[model samples]
Target: MSLIILASLVFLLMPIFLLLYIRSYNRHKKNHFLEKLNMQQKFESEMLQTRVEVQDQTMQSIATELHDNVGQLLSLTTLTLNSVNLNDAEKAKKKIDNSLSLVNKSIKELRELAKLLHGEQLVENGIGHAIHQEINWLNKTGAYELKINNQLLDVQVTSPDKDLIILRLLQEIINNIIKHAQAKHIQIDSYLEKNALHLRVRDNGVGFDPNEIKVKKSGMGLNSIYKRIEMINGKLALNSAPGEGTSISIEIPYP
Candidate 1:
């Protein structure tokens, strides 16, 4: 009779133990999910901050270009009008013609700048060709050694906004290299990885700490790269060390 009672008690306690185990497991899972969610939120917040900073800097750069070049040209045209005597019609006409020519040149340069700001044809062509053209410009300048490895022969990722983000991001990167890194050999590669487009920009230059993105002034550019990627729901990875080299890779999801 005692054995029967003990067996019954054990059967009752088994379900209780199972219930306790399930409750503990649920708690653990909830904590894990919460932790993951918090991390993602933090990452998003940081990315937002970076985007704001980068966009502001880009706008400032454009504003400076306009004031320094276009504004000055306009001011000179005004001064020429004010200084020249009206009695000298032919000479004034000649001066006016010269001023008009200068204005035209300034307009042409401003158009190029506008093209850059607009990200002209990023969607019509794939990112690979777009990058090829940008590097071609850099090559023509003979400022940096720019090489591209074609890996996305038939891949097409098209979006005006994404294109602008990527092109501008690289522009900032190259600008940083020109002004700071003094990089010589720069190789860029673009390919498709899994369900996304991947790009890598490698430079043989004086690289610095990736952690320094927090304190370094040039960190803004790096942060821009990251935020741009994030804006497209992409992924970015940077590898660099002082006096070594830098390789930045970005992966954009297919939209």
Candidate 2:
């Protein structure tokens, strides 16, 4: 009779133990699910923020180009027109011809600026062309010698979000070079390798110690670049030294 009673107790406790185990497992599963959902939401938020920052930077660039390049050209044309004297036909003809030429140059510049104005449309065309457009704009500055090796140009694979992020990354890198790096030569290489897309930008600029930058938590938009790369499930390798230069390489899984 005692043995029977002990067996009954064991049987009763078995269900209770199983119920407790299941409840604990269910709670853990719920917590895991919530964590994944939160990470997804955070990624989406970062992507949106990056998009806005890139557009704002583009607009600022446009304003500067207009004021410095096209605007200056137009202002010169105005001054030339104002100086024209209708009293002297020969002199007036010469000034008019010069003004016409200036106006034509301004129109050409405006057309180029128009291309820049449609920043989103650039990515829509394709990442290759978008990249070419960016390099072209930077080349206009004539500040550095650029060596470009773009293997993805003719290879048509569309990843719009990644493209924008990559473009912005390039912009930030370039901005850093302009602001801090006093180097003169830049090389950019992009290609596909082992089902992954790779982009590398190197510059012969005054580079600082990466460890120092990490400790200081400043310069070259490093924090922003790392965050964006994380959001896209990409990896970044930065190489730099104090008088040597800086190189940034990014690798991402492709479409």
Candidate 3:
């Protein structure tokens, strides 16, 4: 009689226990889904911010080129034409030729600037081509000795969003080098291997202790780089020490 009572109690409680278990499971499932949605939103927000920064950087570059380079060339061309003496055929011919040369150079620079204006489109072409364009711009500065071994130029596969982020990361790195590295030699290597894309940048610059930067919690745009790398689920290895050059290696899964 006692066993029968116990069995009846168990049977009566089974539905309540099952209902509680289902409720707990559903709650956990909903929470997990919400957490994922939040992460996706955050990633999208960061991407938008990155895009804006890239565009701003491009515009700043364009403005500087127009003011410091193209502007100067055009001004020189105008001055040369104004100084021309029409009565002296030979001298006038020389001045005209000089002005023509300046004008041609100005046109060339404007053409290059036009290409830069289409920074977004450049990434669309392919990450490799985008990188090549960036390297070409850096080379034009002639401030550093650059050794480049970029193997992505012919690569047909591309991740549009990743490409843009990667380009911006490169830009930030180059900016740091220009502003603070005080180094003369820069070596960049990029390639694809074993289903991962690898980028390595080494600079012979006055390096700083990475620990110091970490302690201070700011410097060299390292924080931004780390966040972006995390956003892409990529990895970055940075090595540097006082009086020693800095080297950064990054690996990301390819599309």
- Global Cα RMSD, each model: 5.9, 2.0, 1.4
How many residue-pair clashes does candidate 2 contain?
0
Which candidate wins on TM-score?
Answer: 3
Question: Model 2: per-residue lDDT, tens digit, 116-167?
Answer: 8888888888778878988987888899999999888897888988888888
Better of 1 and 2 by TM-score: 2
Candidate that beats the other on lDDT, 2 or 3, i.e. the better one = 3
Cα lDDT tens digits, model 3, 89-165, are 99999999999999999999999999999999999999998889889878877788999999999998999999999
Taking the tens digit of each residue's C-alpha lDDT, what string does model 1 give over 36-150?
A: 9997787667545544544564466567668876788878877777766769998889778878887897797577556545334533576666576566556745667678886
> Residue 19 lDDT in model 3?
99
How high is each candidate's TM-score? Answer: 0.60, 0.91, 0.96
Clashes of 1: 0
Compare the candidates by lDDT and give the number of the best one. Answer: 3
**Could you tell me which residue pairs clash in candidate 2?**
none
TM-score of candidate 1 against the unseen true structure: 0.60
